[model samples]
Target: MRWLFPALALMVSTAAFAGADTLFVGGFQNAALARGGSNFLWYRVDRVPPDAADPVQSCIDARDPYGILANYHRAGVRNTVRTQLRAMRDAGQQRIATGIVHLRAPAGQSVDGRYGGTLIDSTGGTLHPRIRDNLVAFLRDVYRAGFSELLFRYFPQGDNTPVWWTTFDESLFQENWQLIRSIEPILQASGLSYRTDLGVEGMPRAWFVEALGQYYIDDNRPDNPAWSEYARRIWRNYVAEFDYRRSVGFSFVSDSDPVRTRARVRHLRYIYMLADGSVRYPPLFAIDIYGGGTTDERTIFERHHHAMADLGRNEPWIVAESYFNDAVAAAGLSSAMATTGRQVRYFLQWPLDRGIDDCGVNVAPPNAYEAWLRRGF
Candidate 1:
């Protein structure tokens, strides 16, 4: 039985993970690199575009012939997304949509019209009529924006199209499961769309279970409970979201970590494998590893690479974000390339569009960090 585990794991991985590398520079900081035949570019919709034009249009203008991954923070009520999609279609740019959407249940008002009642009531439910209406309006907005095509960017069946869309950015579980539970049925009834990543926290003891497991639930979960209750909360919070999303339409919902330790990565893969006994959920993962020459930074990269390889020869994952010293940008690139799988499904470095300087990497060009990336490509 012990030996059979390896064979079964190999079979699962071989069937689950397969695709060419898809690297993305965090933003348009090195737009020229994207233009000069390097990796694809990523950007947030609210951020100003390189040409100071529309965000979607500026990305298309890069002439990458591939596409850009976009983050949307607005409430899906955009008046101009239709025009933007037209421009994108004309250029044949395949845009992948991500980013957060804050859909809270409508607050109840007092008779005096001053304050409110409990947002989530005693029922442990959130799908009020108003909440349902809000979801409907949002879906209608999405339909008008032509975002259904954008959100459904990946092929539902296989790993050949490993593009990711972490739907709620880093705020997925933060909004309470009751809210998400309400949203899911609306998503189903509205027939808005399907297939997205759940943007969950990576650092949790639920990922690990030696012969004896440790207890570390996120702040969103109950603090201390009996072992059975602890297990139930973990299943509800971490494990059940995948099945719920899959039930609606999501094919490969991903879990991302900061990539600080190999254990986190290994355990996440373990959780994905064990929970997904049927292999319905591909072992999709994401990591964040800032690169540099320092021992701490280099160790971060090394440990992540080792952990990423635990599953199979070519497990597709994303280098979601990073920061690197210009002096050792090549070393950083090399560190990013240190994983068992030669392919990088997606690579989006940090602060690609922000004006502020992040560890010397900024929006302005002619910076050492941008130069370093160009040299590597």
Candidate 2:
């Protein structure tokens, strides 16, 4: 008989981890890397630590389970990433864990990636070869750098600013679909099993997607039947784009307006409804749990839960980010080891009691998380 680890009841989205459910962070800074499980370093092309010294090497030194390179891609920023990959190799740590973000160059900044004028180029039924070649080149760089455990975050909230999170309209959705089509080959070529996340701002419903697709360019369809046909076709195109798993990601801002938050909930429900009829709630759903809320975490989490239950199927949700926020209850005011230790255990078990999965921790780990590993949890 094959040796088996005790069931942890941890839920991972993929079959690859058939026997184990491990902990990880969505992304992190210097402090979190020192902890354990998975570490995410923002691959900012513009800002590499001086002298090619890798920030991740130290995480490797600490022997963290995974090193995730979260790409915050900027134009003409390849060298910094390339240099760091070499640093990883020198440190004898290849194949960094990563979350692939396929986003455009925000509103301003150079459109340095393969797509031009926007994240998807001309925004029609065509693929840009230059962009495809560029994507190929970038992925090649990723491979050379010894990166693995890639999670492709579909649709970027990218280089996104506080002024705007992400605007989801009809045309952008189609373009993102095409964007996925353009890169699937390169992603496949990397020779690593990959995970994918799905999301769009406001989490628009199927009707919205249908309306936007049908009337976005032209709402002047003279006949009512023609409009229905157009809307149906549009929904098909939009839904067809999602070839990956059923998943959604949410982030909380410092804003606490109940009206706005509730509106956002409605949009997310739309996503749930559409998927329920088809993919049926892809195994993994992630939330970036931040602190310093206008509303308390408990209230917020319950509200989101109610929305899901309203949709008729509520699976275990993943707390993909936590304790890293400046105002979070877990992190508190200090980085004291003891404080975080207490906080980590309290929250991890707390969410479990509420049907949420404690998946990723942002920032660093406390002795508490380490203690779980020690106990074979």
Candidate 3:
């Protein structure tokens, strides 16, 4: 007899047991193609020039506009900002989270490069006029989308490059917050709750020092003071824009060090204190775990899991991004599935057992087994 696994039933059961907290396990599929031999496809509506065609439509007609916009905002394509928001609503995804920048490029020029294209002009001035108009249009579309939640990620992973890292200035950073303030009215009108990922690496020094204290900084000063200071300021300004005292949530990505992860989690707790004396809003702590044969990837995930469990005091945790490299290609589907399944099951059982509320799996497409795992197999 052919039997279908009651995947949704299991998910419902798990979710019920886990209470209101939901575990979001999905892939970061590429817009243009499927990964790993599965139908999972990521729809990207941003980054490409407005005049350029959407490559994913050719393969999969159905699109996740919210996902696309989230990715695009990180990539910095402002032209299609409104179009993407509308697409998300039309595609049945009401809530969305997007990123913003304090600067803009000249009219007719494209900021098509990764991590939301260059925001500053050649002379190091804000791109307020150009970006403001685009943002107004974008926020209007977001309002039209009927979204109830808006999560803004100030420092995206792609922006980890030296150029983006070093270029951030206090004035420009404050301008970004100002942009958020200007758009708050639209968000309020839409009845959306706003959250942001103030990843530890992106926070400002004063805020970081205030939150994590100088001891933590001295312990994990991987980069020079300038770079670390810049990152901290980015994090601070991003968080400062939001009223954490009110039910706003904050997220942070883990550094490679286990000690640092624990320290970051502690710091986030301090941020929670500043927000409201209680950790009401979700505290999203993510760690990058790339799965491959390399020792570095394995080490990263191992340390991440240990650190999370070590530092987790009933906070929400997510494996923000994970990639299976070419080394794992030879392992085939069965091997890959077994390994991936073991990891997922481990996180679900161990952390959830310890009272952690949420866990997310990030994957690419074309892997049927991985897709099954994501669907909660």
Candidate 4:
């Protein structure tokens, strides 16, 4: 029987000896690509960069990560997917964790070309059929293009390869759920893969719950029967759509925020109960603590630690993304973990990412944090 924390087993077992117990550490661009052990880096699978610098090989030269968290968005074209995949193989990157950053069109926006537009039907109540067809075609192309060994957010049974999976830079809006509902079954049916990183963003806090429509149900706040019941209905739909496959799990990514952390943990517990104990994979919570150096990450992180414990479950977590170039923020994050008895399963650094020029938040080159990060790590 598959047990809970299959991904956690891979992470915790390897990291236990490190004393810090971080399973994977990595982030947006070249900074994370240089670190050893499991690391994450973003790529625009739709096109190859024209740059002369080869960061992937440099990372392998330092040490092969247990796996690479290859983050991408759903808008990528298939030809670019083939091009990028070939490039990665040529570069000698074997273990890969493929994640879609934003699965659906951002609220009020739409995607161009083959992947189609919004997933919602005209009534705004269900998934559009074309979304599933497009997704299936895209994934089949990916599977055919020499990506047989895959890693999802939840570790699948009989697959021992360890890869860290997490969502980045997007919140879990209702549309995201609709997209998952449409895509997950196709993955399972074709046996291409299972388990997608349920994107949970911390910056949105109350907006996250309110937008997710789970406020009274799993927010750990005072209950309102009507609201709680509505939340339960939503959870029921999630369970029905997911069908207890052990294929879906959580991977949080955002700048640190205590309220969001508390609500997500409690929310997971409620989900487990609603599944009638069918949900087995432990939802791994990770944070992408980003700032321009003014945010008090330490205090926020400390609150996050306590909030997890206060809810009655405490598991080793991941510092999935951070601007580790800032010495003060880095030190504060480390100290908070030590003081709170919370062990890190991974610590990834986010430096200026030159690979994807479209990224709004990428830090430009000559970053002082790069020098500081290299010296500090």
Estimate the Cα RMSD of every predicted model relative to the unseen true structure.
14.5, 14.5, 14.0, 13.6
RMSD of 4: 13.6
In terms of TM-score, how similar is model 1 to the real structure? 0.43
Write model 1 residue lDDT over 1-377, tens digit each, in one string: 00101111222101111122122446422211111111112221233345554533333233211112111223442334334434433332222232222222224531111111111121232444443453365445545544222122111111111112112222222333444455555555545444333332322222322344543423223222222132233334534564433321221122233332433443342233333353333333444444433343345555555655654424444444444223343354454454332444433343332222221122211122343344332
Q: Tens digit of lDDT per residue, candidate 2, span 1-377?
A: 00001111111023243222233434211122112122233332122233445533332233222122222244544566577556544532222233333344334432433232223332342344555554556567766655434444443433211112233244544555455555555666766544443332213222222264342212222123322232233334434664434233322222234444444444443333342355334454444333333555544455555544565545444334334212333332113222222112111211111111122221221112332222221
* Candidate 4 structure lDDT: 0.39
Query: Which 10 consecutive residues of model 1 have the lowest summed lDDT?
Result: 153-162
- What TM-score does candidate 3 reach? 0.45
* lDDT (Cα atoms) of all candidates against the true structure: 0.32, 0.35, 0.34, 0.39
* Full-model lDDT, candidate 3: 0.34
State which candidate, 1 or 4, has the greater TM-score. Answer: 4
What C-alpha lDDT, on a 0 to 100 scale, does residue 269 get in candidate 4? 50
Alpha-carbon shift of residue 103 in model 3 (angstroms):
5.1
Write model 3 residue lDDT over 142-229, tens digit each, in one string.
5565554444444322222222444445554454445445544544554445444443134222122335443334333333344445
Local lDDT at 190 for model 1: 46
User: Rank order by TM-score, top first?
Assistant: 4, 2, 3, 1
